[model samples]
Target: MFAMLVDFASPVSLDWLTLSVIPILFYYFVYTIYSLYFSPLANYPGPFFAKISSWPNFYHSTTGYRHIWIWQCHQKYGDAFRFKPDGVLFNSPSAYRTIYNSRANVKKGKFYEIWPRNTQNINTLTTIDKSAHGRKRRVLNSAFSEKAIRSAAGFVSEHVDRWNEVFLADNDGKEWTSPKNMSKMADYLVFDIMGDLCFGKSFELKEPGENEFRHMPHTIAEYMQFMYPASMITQSPMMKFWVWLKPRGLDSLFESMLPKNIRSYYEFVEANVARRQKEEEVLKRSDAEEGRGRNDLFHYLFNATDELGNPGYNTDELYAEANLLIIAGSDTTATTLVGFWFYITRNLRVYEKLVKEIRTAFDRAEDIQVGTTLSSCNYLQACIDEVLRAAPAGVADLVREVLPGGLEIEGGRLPEGTQLGVAQWSIMHHEESFGDPWTFRPERWIADSSTGVTPEDVARARSAFNPFTIGAGNCVGQKFAMEELLITVARTLWRMDARLVPGDNLGAGSSKLGWGSRDKNHIVLRDAWISIKDGPMVQFRKRVD
Candidate 1:
């Protein structure tokens, strides 16, 4: 009797287990069928698993190859392809303009909201609210005004001059310094400059010694790696729970999960903001305040007023805006500078043409200030444009979600709330838009008859090129970026000659990297929203007249 009772109980337990799992499996099977064959996005081509789940997109994002994956999908599936359940990417110039133009009926997707430190730390980049972003943007506009940028040129030149000195420091009177990783060097230089501009004092990360903040770049990169993937997760079908949890407990959980280095970075930013506020107060009280307070970018931000002529930002808002300025101002310029060195060092023709233009435009490096002569260097502009093309600061899509009433793009109407964007890497490399898109060609930007690049051809390229993006959400500090790039490239090339270390391709794509990143000539950038890259180790020597 006991043996018979035990046998019956075991079978009953087994039946219950089977009943629970079967329903789950059945539900998933039905959902997959609907997602692939019956949803509004059914016709969009994508990896089979990506259609069924968002895990594929999340996996690629965490691997830091999301950009290359999208490029590969575009190659196989044509211009428009689904990357996630509700996410579609378009790869054409017209599609880019249609989706991101000022008049577009779309707003930044929920992906942006994942960036702020908490609900209270909203800034220009993380805010999804249109009116709040507009207000914040108006305030930031004063921080990068023409007068402010002109004042900033002096600070930029000082930092660049000092950085050059450090590069040549232990040369031992040799023709060149030992091969320096341009990626690390550029980070140190740009971070120090951003420190000085955003705060009152420089971080001095480039000064070649013990510094508490030397690891800040690495901190920022790691932070981005985690956040970029998490942001993608929010756009998936599973995001319903995530969205519900964020306001309830997830924000605090995220803050707690921050690594020690990230916490240190936040502390550093907070300290700087406090110190700068104190100094601003003192400056406001001084009689010679007109020129007493240094006219750095921070000064402009501190003194800026709102539309109602009130202080533009309160304490919490200032901390948020100031932090964004440092990241945006520093990282973008550093990425471009590193990319410029990598490409120019590899391509001698581009290097020689650009150097000649800079040399001819200015008899002395000091004359390479931000003005008519500097702006007139067409070849210099072209080289910068090419670098931005080949290695954009942000390699991923500028994710935007359709607003109410839906929207039209590339001749197709996307339903409201669908997330879509033009992937920068895929669109810029579109063969139809740019002939020989993989090649590093700067002459394509010029309208010279000698190069057979006509005015129409140049216009066509311009239509596809959006280094700073365009319209309402365009980069506010574009002029500042251009000035800094112009100054850094011109001055560095003038004071020093540089070349890639023999057979050293630290930053170039290798066969081991797989498709869309196997070209030896192409600089490889890992996508973490803003690009993460390494180097083409280079050696530099002081230029001889």
Candidate 2:
């Protein structure tokens, strides 16, 4: 029987290879025709190549030019355009609201789930399950509340003070000292603050001596470099096989690919969470008899309970949240500071005006507290607003999937399973949204008639402004971020006079997309999921009143 089967197989020949190729070609032909002219999204204007394949979008994303590419497409295709066969990019403010509406049934797309925590448990940010996200959000809200932020304010100040000392010591009493890149300095400062808040201790990154976590920022950058391609890879048809083999094959592949420091970072968070849990256990035992305890972000998170007195988060969830807090809290605030310094230093007029505002607003640098006097510095706030507008930290798309019954957008109805979002870089720089959109003018946010900023201009800018985004899933640490920015900026400007290094165009507009430079500065930032800013070297000197 075996010999007979072999004899029969010999008669088939090599013609079957041609048979297999024909169906694949046919399928491609059918898909191209459908996606280009017969699909539900066929009417949407976009590059013909983009409408047929995901490769164009994926290629731009991997090269950190996704934001720039989308912005350019909007320039060609107008406010609404198809960015991928399965996705649409919107440039209008109303479109942003519609896509991210709290009442909408939309859910975060597959992209959010691509990056997994070491524990393999979904955290608030990565969770696509709406009900689970709601539960997590409820518990996490306590950690970022008004009282919680106020409690954490001292940590912010303490770290800032330490950073100042570190900066000055590095200067060695020179009248003018160039530390090169302000971006790394800001990262170290913010990392220390976030370390103290999230881990119940400081990483001491701003200390004079060697620190174990000094490479954290670089490690994070490396980790983010993996995210863009990984996200796109997970969206492919082969992802099913990848997921199936993830437990053994792909898991090891991912683990081996991670930078040593990235692995160490996760290990550090796990250890820190374990240490804090032990401390909380001791504190609970002592609290029953005595009253000795401390209040910080972890304290709030640990004690958070729902209406029924159930704990807000389990052990894995606690680990996940702690990991997220460090990354989100530190990276964003640090990036914003980097952009803020780049702009203000380059634009001497804005710098001098901000300096005057900071010096006049407080008699001493100590008076620059978070909510008290810092909030009153309108010019400082305007500078922050302008920085966020021109060079936002989260420059890429905050993607969401359209739900059943389909969703109504500005242009038309999008079918269910469609992924869409407003590319933040495009919306903020939309010509209709602001006058001289490419220019870094804080006056657009100031509403001053004499400065040529009309109330209408301010209103229009405000409508389009979504630095931290909006709605239910908006940044939980929004207030915390604002407080940190105001205090850090006001205190730094008050104590130091910063001048832009010669021949640096870090803050200048280098791209047709608007703010960041392609040369030295890259102030608008080169997007890699998280924006990567190079340098805006500034010489700093102690202010003499």
lDDT string for model 1 (40-103, tens) is 7888898888888889988999999989999999999999988877778999889889988888
- Using Cα atoms with residue i matched to residue i, what is each candidate's TM-score against the true structure? 0.96, 0.93
Which residue ranges in model 1 land beyond 4 Å of their true spot?
1-9, 172-174, 285-289
Worst 10 residues of 1 by lDDT: 2-11
- Write model 2 residue lDDT over 1-545, tens digit each, in one string: 87765553553644666678899999989999998988889989999898988888878877776788888899899988987788888999899989887887588888876666443656889887888888889899987888889888888887887677666775664577755578888888988888889877888777767877899988888778767777876555436354455665666788888777877887888898999988887888766543255567888898898768899988888888888888888878988998888878767888889899899989888877876577778888998999888888888888898889999888598999888899888888888888677777988888776898888888998989998888778899988998899888888778887788887764445645542334333355667778777667777778866
> Over the full model, what C-alpha lDDT does candidate 1 score relative to the true structure?
0.87
Pairs in steric clash, model 1: 507-535
